[model samples]
Target: MSQAPASFSAVTPYRPSDAGRSLMVNDKHRQILDGLREISQESSSRGYHAKAVTSAVDGLRGCAFPVNSYLKDGNPNRRCIVYPDFEIEFEVGSYYGGPQTDVSIVDIRIFRSETKTNTRAALWNVTHTENESGSEWKRSRDPESQLKPTPKCSGTENDSIKIGINGFCKNIDHAISMLPSHITRGNETSLGKLKSSGYQLFYIPQSNSYFRAGWSFVRDLGRTSPSDLKSSQILASHMREAHENGLFIEWTSHRGGSKPLTQAMKLLAKQGVNVAGKQKVFLSDHTSSHFEADRARRAIGMNTTDSKWHNSTKGIAQLVGGQIFGGASLACSINELINHTKREELGGKIAVIGSTAIGGGIAINSTYEKIGKLIAEHGVSPALALSVLSVIGKTAIVGVAAASIPSLNENYHNGPQDPIKNLGNKIGKKLIPQG
Candidate 1:
């Protein structure tokens, strides 16, 4: 392994975590989730993100400082519940077993695909670069190699720089079913493995899938229609099986205040998802001083209405062990503000929201949704699809992030539809590229 960076700074200033500090969670906004009980009574159907954020804020804040001194598992934060502001699901199998996985994503953008700009934005650049096998390439020459003339390194063979390739299809099952054939043909291999330690999946849709149900609908985004119960059994079964298999069943996501978001969260639950998280803000009543002061620190954080507040349902958090952390989901977008807290009162009470299956899709956008589902369903093309999905997710998110910047007016516009969008999507009625 390569040596760690020698001069890496391993310390953060002893600044307290506050409502304002949540801005650091992402490059976008600043916020604080004081309390959650209130929001639940207000909004009836925002979805998984709402509930997850509410619970996350309440739970995490409840445990953040109760134990000043750290020991081990005995302490509240014995485990650093590091919620990487983003995630993308990688398929493992069904409620049973398998080597390959289906691809999918859980995101807010899926529902927002109606607009032409959003649709264009959803379509992302997919690049298929060179892929190489691990066979050693020795420079040493015997009779054959030495006799041949050395190739000139004019320093320009774009083809030499390898990249990952993915094959997308309209029908998810169709795409997944084609994985083995591609593998057998010795096609699409990745050379640039992660150089850093630790494992992480890109939280993109099609890049994220499994299933969903109703109770989750109620628990996650707040609207529980009777129809959702249909898939509950299968979702629970899958979760239980995944738990038993010693794999991560990420039941949490960043979907929206819609029915689909709720459904997604429920499916993830049976998989032993760690916890849910969401956006939140400190709120106060017009009446009492103590009440106003205590508002942001109590169950008041649940009024997730505006973009500045935790806007999803509150029940999602109830599913996992409390893991609420602030989503910094706010209207306050300022770099300096993000780098530093907005007010001293911000830290008086830190809010932590639950996790979710929302942004996982939006970050990757709708174009890849079908691909994301394919992986989850079939667990096929795990490596190639994952690499491609991961890249597209990061790239698209980068595009979103670049736009979300305060300087850019915080509006996402991916531009006109073209080959750039839907990078891996085929033009004709072909599932995989034939050799």
Candidate 2:
């Protein structure tokens, strides 16, 4: 990692006032930003600006949150991660030139202790708009248009707690102007109260020449503090957990060799997360047209011989089978219903419907078994797979019961039938086949 350039010391500190609270950029944060800019510039020179900047931030000491799990879009220029106190947003430029190539801190808003009637009390707030002229940079200035929060920061109950609100606005002025009335209205309104009331907002500076925005929440942050481990270790643990839980993991790596993949698999095996013959792993590499993923597979195999890792062929086959069987069962049920509607005796109609539903249930159960096998084959624990399938199976049974009971009732009361004694005989013959 590159050190912050010495010349960055000459840059003036940014200070902004909110109500009576004054926020200033301290030396440590300045140095961190300066270091980030140095990394960004070096990366931009090599035409790898976005990935390099994000990688630097992800590895920064003290910022140990697992960013990859939440962000899976494979976008190169933007990334966001939330921390307990604050969140960080990175907007990387596409090309090198002028302000487009420059990496600068755009805005920072800190929640401060509230006093008196005014709700807006900023512990730290600064906005830098000197680079606002960059061609790629655009921010919404119309308060009316901007009042409707960004989709990512819409202040919904669950979202406010998990991800909070971090997005872009033209400047601090525009951001303040766009604050929902409820946020700007309360007295003695602390961050905790605002959070409880479900009004959370964070803004990214629009001055930098970057457009795309991506953000993700860390659900496990409470369970495992990022401060406990280095960022790399945190990331590795996240990857292992994702694989063990049957989640699809994807990340962009600029490294030149297969050592990363080999080592990762070895770590997984060491942690007992990868079990041979019990799970299958799939590797995908889009780095080159020569199919480097094949090479990676061989490397992983060499390193972790006991781990079962292979292609997606078996998974695809199981998925196809499940779909085919599920469709066939649905079609058969509908067809049986039609045939039952045509029956002359109400008892016979009800019996045929009952038999058809039982057959459909059997078919659905078989489909669930195939799906469970597919899940288990792909590294998920059998218990987890069975639990999931069990839920689906129970739901299916309830649905079948609900549909059948209504039809039986309607047919029994509404349709004409023979004498009561003959009805039993009619239904018995329809339900059971005789030689």
Q: Please, what are the lDDT tens digits per residue for candidate 1 over residues 1-435?
A: 122122211212111343312111111111222222344445553333345444433333231311111123343312222111211111111211222121111111112222112111011111112337532212111111001112321112221111111111222222222222221222223212211111111112221122221112224343333323322222223323333343322121112112222332344432334221221221110111223222322231222343422112122222111222233332231222234433321111111100111222222344245343444333234343344444434433343321111121111112211111223232111232223
Off by over 4 Å in 2: 1-7, 10-294, 297-304, 311-435
Q: Each candidate: how many clashes? A: 91, 0
lDDT (CA) per prediction? 0.23, 0.30
lDDT of candidate model 1 versus the reference: 0.23
Q: Lowest summed-lDDT stretch of 10 residues in model 2?
A: 406-415
lDDT of 2 by residue, 163-209 (tens): 11112233344333333221322124433343333322223223222
- Per-candidate alpha-carbon RMSD to the true structure: 29.7, 22.9
